[model samples]
Target: MIAHLADIESMEKSFRTNLINHLTGGKAVHLIGTYNEHHQSNLAIFSNVIHIGAYPAMIGVLFRPIGENSHTYKNIQANKQFTLNQIPLSMVQQAHQTSARYPFGTSEFEACEIEEETIPEFDGPFVKHSLIKMGLIWEEEHLIKSNQTVLLVGKIQYISIEDSILLPDGHIDLGLAQSLSAGGLDTYYQLNQLTQFPYAKVLADASHEPRRNS
Candidate 1:
């Protein structure tokens, strides 16, 4: 199972891709929705979405190198808005299908037979079936020179979650929402709560107590 950089590079292209992707471990799965100025909607599944900040509610999503037609990225750039919808266990199949390459202007919502939900005052569409969804406004884009990947930063403008899932201290019980995670390119996983712990703190007094000999 040991693999060095040279070994990974020498592996088959598809095998290497899957290996490297899974090496990073499980990632939160989300459906990114966007709409171009022409009103053409695009829906795509992404596992690279990351929380950047809490105060401003910023999130960063990594997009692959720009190709002839990167519909999602193009739409975000066009209108400066997008939505992230959590994929539940029941909809994993349709969520993964969103990653399929479709012709430009093709609405993955329609193609995948998923319903599109829109909120007033928001510019992009959201997955109506998702228990937790977020509307984001584009903030910035960073170019990774080494890989030519684009990191898009956006601010959360709106969030809709099922009432029963939210906790008092601001943590949402994702398990209750049946949120799914991505293991690799095509595998999806369900999660369960193992345990919860309080934040660690340093003892104010470091006095040691006598220990009884066993």
Candidate 2:
């Protein structure tokens, strides 16, 4: 199982990709919805979304090198607005289908038969099927010199969470929502909360740590 850079580079392309992607374990999966200047909608599944900050409420999505085929990237670039929609377990197949290489201007929402929804004042469409949705404005982007991938950051402008999953303390329970997560590129997993802990503070004796199955 030991693999160095040479060993990894020598592996088959698919194997290398899968190995590297899976090494990160489960990743949050969402359908990024965007719109072009023509007002055409585009929806694509992305697992590279990450929380950038809470103070400014920013998120980042890593996109492959911008190219003619990068419809989502182009749409976000053109409109500066996008939506991230969480995929529920029931819609895993439909969400994955959004990754297909449909021609430019062909809406994946329609091609995949997923309903599209819009909120007041937002330019991008949201997934009507998703229980958790967020509308964001493009804040900035950076190109990764090593890989040529683009890290596009967005500021959260609006968010909708299913009422039942919203906790009293503000945590969203993914298990209650039945949200689906991607293991790598193709594998899907269901989430279940294992435990919760209070804000960490170092103690003199270090004897007050919360214990589960103790």
Candidate 3:
């Protein structure tokens, strides 16, 4: 059953939660920077990050243009570098606040009341409290004309993660991260791996694991 409401503004009049209820799972860490005309530092957070390729160790994210004039898009055009930080449940509130549209030169770190840290030689900013963070240098930028969305692709140049999250198999143990996800509108939830099956396990005969009759 689908209910299409013609009342759009009325919907926002209540609680205007982000409409993106279903993101492609495996939420990504998104950090973005853009310098305003005054050259003041502007930092923002995004969870819609995605990996584009392995051979190049690249990732891409879409930033909706800020009206007709966007300092974030311009900053990427100028500096060509940005940082991304993976958020855990602890920082959910702060991450949510970054979506606000603020003036250029406004520090989201200050607005969100979160601390910001900078690397020695990096051009963008990193979330000081995130579980994982990465620095990306621009490789390319694409403008999707029909939607006016900007797709910024960059090569990951540096990364940092908490030691506890690393597993011997070179995979991250989300169990240790306590990161969260969302389901329906405004409904946030946590996740855990119920089971990890190897290729051999799946290929094994069903009888191999089936309970035998006593």
Per-model TM-score on C-alpha atoms: 0.93, 0.94, 0.75
Overall lDDT per candidate, in order of appearance: 0.91, 0.92, 0.70
- State the weakest 10-residue window (summed lDDT) of model 1: 200-209
Task: Report the Cα lDDT for residue 49, model 3.
Answer: 65
- Give candidate 1's error at residue 206 in angstroms: 7.6
What would the per-residue lDDT of candidate 2 be over residues 130-182, giving only the tens digit for each residue? 98999999999999999899999999999999899999989999888988878
Off by over 4 Å in 3: 2-26, 33-39, 66-69, 182-187, 199-214
The TM-score of candidate 1 is 0.93
Clashing pairs in 1: none
Cα RMSD of all models vs. native, in order, equals 3.5, 4.0, 5.8
Better of 1 and 3 by lDDT: 1
Q: What is the C-alpha lDDT profile of model 3 across 1-214, one tens digit per residue?
A: 2325665444664343344334344454444654555556676666556779977899888777646546666777777777777777787777677767777778888888877887786767778887777788889878889977778898989888898898888788776787666442244566686888665645444566668799
> Which parts of model 2 have CA positions greater than 4 angstroms off?
207-214
| Global lDDT of model 1 | 0.91
Q: Show the lowest summed lDDT stretch of 10 residues, model 3.
A: 14-23
* Residue 145 miss distance in model 3 (angstroms): 3.8
| lDDT (Cα, tens digit) per residue for candidate 1, span 65-158 | 9898789998998899999999878888988998899999899999999999987968789999998999999999999999999999999999
lDDT of 2 at 143: 97
Scored against the true structure, residue 129 in model 1 reaches a CA lDDT of 90
